[model samples]
Target: MSRGKTASALDLPRPDTLDAGKQQGAYEALRGAILNRQLPAGSRLPSTRSLAERWLVSRGTLEAAFDRLHSEGYVQRVAGSGTRVCAVIPEQFIAAPLAREIPRRPVAPDQPDAGVQSHVPFVARRPDASLFDLKTWARCISRGLLTVGPGVLEAAHPAGLPELRAQIADYLRSYRGMQCEADEVIVTTGIRHALDLIARSVLKPGDTACVEDPGYLPARRLFALAGAHIHAIPVTADGLDTAQLPEAARLAYVTPAHQAPLGMTLSVSRRLALLDWAARADAWVVEDDYDSEYNYNTAPLAALKSLDSGDRVIYCGSFNKNLFPGLRVGFMVVPNVLRRSMLRTLQLTGHSVGASDQLGLVEFLRSGAFVRHLRASRQAYQARRDALLECLGGHCTVSGQQAGLHFVLWLPPGVEEGDFCSRAAAVGLTLQPLGKFCHALALPPAVIIGYTALTLAQIRFHGRALAQLL
Candidate 1:
C-alpha cells in the first residue's frame, strides 16, 4: 500500500504521520468530515503541491487518495482552480430535517403532497419524461400505418390496439409461458393503467381490495382513487402474506413475480394459497408481473395467471421494464368470464394508447429483437446490481436483489432515510428513502435504490457517496 500511484499525500489528517493501512482510514475520515459539513461545501482543498509538503508524503500517494475521495463524491474538481468540497451538501444528510415523521393530524390520502409540508421544495424525480427507445418505435409506428386499415386508426378501443393485443399474446406464449390469446390481453398505458382498469372493472367504490401494506404506492393510490377501500395486507420475505389476508376483500393486487421493495418471489406455497383464497372468496387477483425481465436468480417465475386453473387471476405484463418506462404499452390476461366487463371498463376509462405504437411494438416483438434486447439488458442490469451491492456492502446491509430494477436498504432505526438522501443529493447522489414506499404512519425507515437506469461505474460512484450519507 506504499504510495501505489505517483500522487502525494492529501491535505488534512497530516499524511506523513500515518502508516500504510491508515491512508484508507484518513481517506474515510475526511470523507465523513465533508459530508458532516465540517469542511464546508465548496471550500477549496489544499493543492497536491501543498498537501505533499504538509504531509511529507510523495505526490503520487496523495493524488491517489484524492481520486478515491472524488469517486466517493466528497471531493470535486474545478477547471481553473484545484479540488474543492462539493457545493450544496444537503442540510439534512448529516443534519436532521426539522419536521418529524409523525404529525399531530392523521396523514390523509387527499392531503397535499408531502413536499408542500416541508421546508425544502419537492425533490424532483429523475427525468424520464422521454424514454430511450423512441427512434426504433417511430419507425415501427410509420410501418404500422402502412400495414393496417384506415379504419383501425379511426376509433379507439379502450381495450388498446388489437394488433398489439395479438402480438402480446404471441410474445407471452414464446417468453412467459402464459396460455393467453389476443382477446384475453387488455392493453393499457403501463402498470398504473393496469391497476386502474382492474380496480375500476371489479370492485365498487366502497369495496375493499387486499394490497401489500408496504407496497407499490401507485397501486394503493389508484385503488383509492377508484373508490375501493384498500386493505393493507402485510408482505413477508416470501411475497405477500396470504395468511394475513382478511375475509372482507373481493380483490387483491399483487406483484407475485417479484415483490416490489423486497424483491422476494412468491413461494410456491404462497402462490397456491393466494390463488385458492381468490377462488374461494370469489375475488379478483390482479397480478403485476412488472420486472420479470431482469431476474438474477433462477429463471423467472410463472405469472399467477399461468397457474390459475380456476381462472381467478388477472395477470398483467408490460415492456416498460424490458424496453423503457414510457413505451406506454402493457397487456393483461383477464379471466374469460370477466372479459366483457373489463373491456367495458377500459372503454369507459378511455385507456386507449393509440394503435400505431402498439403495432410497432408488435413488429418489434415478432422480429425477435425484444427477446434479444432482454437478454442483453439482463446482463447489463445484473452487473449494475452487483456494483451496487459491492460498493454499498461495507456501509449498509443491502437487501432485495434477486430480481427487478431496484433494491431496498433498511436504515438503522434512529436514522432518517429521507434526511440522509437529501444530504447525499447535495453532493450529487440520488437515493430515495425506503420509507418513501411505506403507506403507514409508523413505517420503518428505508431507501429504495434503483440501479437499472445507471451504469455500473455510476452505481459504484454514486452508491459510495450514498453509503457515506448513511
Candidate 2:
C-alpha cells in the first residue's frame, strides 16, 4: 500500500546539460522541486527504476541521488513506503522574506566589549587555560560516560540532574559557607542563565530592579530586557551602597564576593544592611559570586547567602571562570519560597543543560581535583599579579589587587582615560576603560587590567609597556 500520496510528474532538466555528473544533476533537480513546492512535503517520488528510465539515467545513478537527498534530510525512505519528501525542509534552504527587517532590541553599552581578543594581554575574566589538567578531566569524562544509563538519557529535570545539583550544593556549603541542600540548587548554564531565570520568575514589567552603578552592565541590561526599570545605585569601595537602595525595588543584583571590574569585597556591615533592606522592602537580592575562589591576600569571605537570615538572597556562582569559560556550568541557590517559581520558569522555558557534562563535573568535584586546581590557580594568579605590580611600580596607582583576576589602574592626574586607552591600542594593547563600567556614577580616570590569563613573562612585558606609556 502507498504510504504517501504520489507526486505529479516533474519536468526536471536533463543531466546532460546541467553541471558535472548524472547523479549530481538528479539530486539538484529533486531538491529544487522540493524547495520550490512543485513536489510538496509527504508526496512520494516514483520508484528509482521508473524515475531512472524516465530521465534516461542509470538506476544506480538515480539511487545515489536519492541517497544524497535522504542523507541531507530532503527526503525520508521507509522499507515499504518508499521515498517521501520530508515534512520540513532544512532551515537554511527556507528563504526568508526580503521585504521585512527583523526587529532587534537595542544592545546595552556594557555588552561584551568589542575588539578585546582573548589572546591579547590584559583581557579580563579569562582563566589560564594552560594550567588546566586535561588528562584528569578526560578521565573524569570517561568515567562519567560509563555511568550513563537509561535514566540519564531520559528527559532531565529542568532544575538539572539531582546528583550534580547535590554535588554543587555540598561544594558551596563547604567553600562559600552557605547552608543549602541539593533541592535548593538549580543548575544553570552560567550566571547569565541564573539571572535570566530569576528575572523571569520574580519580576513584572515596570518593577524596579536596583543594579550596582559602575557595576556589571550585563546584569543591568538583562533586567531591563525583562521589562524592569533599572535603577543604577552607586558602588563605593565598600561595594554597593545599601543606603541608596530603592524603596520599591523588586530585585537587587550585586557582585558581592568580588565586585565586578572594581574587585572590592562587600563589607560585612553593608552585607547585613543590604539584607536588612531586602527583608523590610520585600525585595530579592541576587549575589553573583563570580571569581571568589582566586582571592590572594585574605581568606575568601562567606557568600552573601550565608548571612541571609530572611532568605531573601539568591546566591549565584559559575564554574566557567574557575575551570574554563567553555564549561558553561553554574548553579544558583534560591530560597524555598522562590524554588517553585524558579522551577516553573525553567519548565516553561525548557531549560536543560547536557547531562553528560553535569555528570563529569560531579566526578570532578568528587575526586577533589577541583579543590587542587583552585589552590594551584590561586598561587599562579597571585604570582602573575605580583609580577605585573612590580613592573608597574612608581608608574601609576593600582587598586582592587587583593582579590579577583583583574585590578583597576588609576590614570595619573591630568592623564585622560580615553587617550591612555587609545595610546595602548596603537601599540596593539587592549585596555578596558573604567568608564565602560560606569553608568550614572562618574569615576576617576582608570583602566581594568586582567592578569590571570597572562603568563609571568607576558605580564612583565605588558606591564613594562604600560609603564613606559605612562
The reply for model 1, stretches above 4 Å from the true place, is: 1-135, 149-151, 155-158, 440-444
Q: What lDDT score goes with residue 316 in model 1?
A: 80
TM-score of 2: 0.77
What TM-score quantifies how close candidate 1 is to the native fold? 0.69
lDDT of 1 by residue, 380-407 (tens): 7788678768877765776777787777
Candidate 1's error at 89, in angstroms?
62
Clashing pairs in 2: none
Q: How many residue pairs clash in all the candidates, one count each?
A: 14, 0
Alpha-carbon RMSD of each model: 22.1, 7.0
Single out the weakest 10-residue window by summed lDDT for candidate 1: 116-125
Which sections of candidate 2 miss by over 4 Å? 1-117
